[model samples]
Target: MLKDFSAQSLFMGLLTAFVGFASSFAVVLQGLRGVGATELEAASGVMALSVAMGVCAILLSLWTRQPVSIAWSTPGAALLVTAGMPQGGFAYAVGAFAVCAVLIVIAGLFKPLGRAVAAIPAPLANAMLAGVILGLCFAPFTAIASDPLLGLPIFVAWAIVAAFKRLYAVPAALAAFVLVMVLGVDLSGDPAGGVISALAPPVAFVLPQFSLAATISIALPLFVVTMASQNIPGIAVLKVNGYEPKPGPLFAVTGGFSFLSAFFGGHAVNLAAITAAMCAGADAHPDPARRYWAAVVAGAGYIVFGLLAGAVTAFVSLAPPILIEAVAGLALIGAFSGSAVAAFKAPETREAAAVTFLITASGISIGGISGAFWGLVAGAAMLMLLRLARKEA
Candidate 1:
């Protein structure tokens, strides 16, 4: 069933994969740091995640015979960096992955939770997604505040590229890179340059040590965040695109992959929403059936890139900070806008969605978990209680 690949489809697939992977590299580094990993160990973790996500994406797409792009959990990675890393070291972190993995597996195996998730109205789900994206988008503006002169040119370049959406569907990050180089922003301070010096053959695998306190404090919350924030929305994206593959199998595959990758110092692996949307969107192929191969291509690319983790890190290091910030901001703009539109569309749900967005944006923490996770819980609880009261009345 393989047809000659279209240049446009290939470009779209690669573009989506690259931006998705690059945007979350910092969080991956944070995951490594949390686990008491050396620089090389951390790089190795990134490599493993890249390889796992890519491979899984390819296999799933090929098997299902649909265009499916697998991506690292951007939100999950953010949670790890913001909460998991600082709370405890690698052993506890691995415990967190293990717990999350187990929960994902259970959810997949159990019919009820899957059905419950499926039963949630599309608008509400979209609203939740919108809230998540809005919080993510704020990072770029904050970066601009940190360095105006350095961030300005990149931001301008991104806006220009984004404005001309059809000429190039490529993410704004690529344009920002071009502008940063032209503007001569200093990048010597970034630690990405030491990648070569840090490179070495993979070390012996570290086994996870379990502790009740660590699991309760770190692992449980991580598991909740990864599932609620990442996995739930991931399935929603697939459904929204009209690809109704069995959620259980997808969850199992991702969880299994995460369990395996944990030994290599990787945090967790899950379905990607925005990046996966790249393959699912009209851009990948006119015939949705053939788009699966694009994911196959992306998967192969991930394997190759993961093998060269040290080299990639070194290259990333050489890039200017402004370039990274600009690219990340630009890449996420569409997702941010789309999510915002989704969040506020229904008057009835507007307040709850707003609450979710604000709490997530506030970046507050309780019990060592992130605000995003709590925000959802709080919003959902508020909605549920209101519903109950309405029914009683």
Candidate 2:
């Protein structure tokens, strides 16, 4: 009776899950390629992340008795693309994941860090989060600029669909897909263009190399960025949606999952914010209790896609550049807008929030950590200093 399926709820959940999957997939694919993963290996990594997130969602939802949907570490993936994979490559990247996982597990076990993280003012946290996401949304746009002919058509097609059909849901992505096909973006270059490639089974083993230098340089920053950018926001999204699970188990599970996936070429697996929203929102499931199944469905989809990594990679490659940009931009619009509003909501902290937003959007880096991490620290310090000054007065 509890698992009794409703067509409407199931459909909504699936649509939400698919959008998340697509957006994440786009970023993961790029990150993998940047680090020189073969198409197969990259797809496998994506699949691993999907499986990890999906399983976590189902288990967490069932355990908490809430409508929880686990999602791949979106901010983590984005960071891998911007910082981890680019700077250090896959091995170093995994090292970063290990560091992040260890930190998360420790925080969950210790409780203080989790509590401290939770204690951060809602407006400040929200503002910091908005800044982080705003930075991320620019990637696809940059990707489009790098390949304009391919990007422009996709953008035009997205505009047409948005104007004519009010394609608010998955149809927007679908429209972009159709536009790519119509424009004929040269699929002949794809390695497995016509083949129905068999899915590769998940490999059970990965040998992790722990390097002190890499850990400090790559792993530590990765952990900081993942927590600051991904995990915190993810929890916030959950809280906003009225599903508040204990932070300890959630952090432990996500950390453990990231560690496992890291061995198999997965970058960093953690809680999802935007994708989880899809499952948690009114559009996905009104009942809320049934939403866990959406995560299960997404996980299943990830496994399917992972196995057919070769074919999937080929398909994604065949998609025009514009299509990718348009779809990603549209998918992120809601998240960006929501974060923007939250960022500037508090006048007392508005300057700090603005600093976070500008720094993150600047995409600057010093040593290894991203601008977002530094931005938050700077903002938080500014906020704290202002508070202390007022206390003395």
Top lDDT prediction, candidate number: 1
Q: All candidates' lDDT scores?
A: 0.65, 0.62
Per-residue lDDT tens digits of candidate 2, residues 1-393? Answer: 366455544554555455556545767766755554555556667777777766676677667755456666555555556553434346655665677778877767778767865665655555655665564356446646767665555556556665775434434454555565657566566344433344555343445566676676556766776766667666766665556657777878888887787777776766765566555544445676665665556555655556655566556655544455455555555656766786687788888778766876776866545665677678788889888987999
Model 1 lDDT vs. the true structure? 0.65
* Candidate 2: clashing residue pairs, number: 3
Query: What's the C-alpha lDDT at position 128 in model 2?
Result: 53
Candidate 1 has what TM-score? 0.78
Which residue pairs in model 2 clash with each other?
Answer: 96-219, 151-322, 199-307
Clashes of 1: 4
Best by TM-score: 1
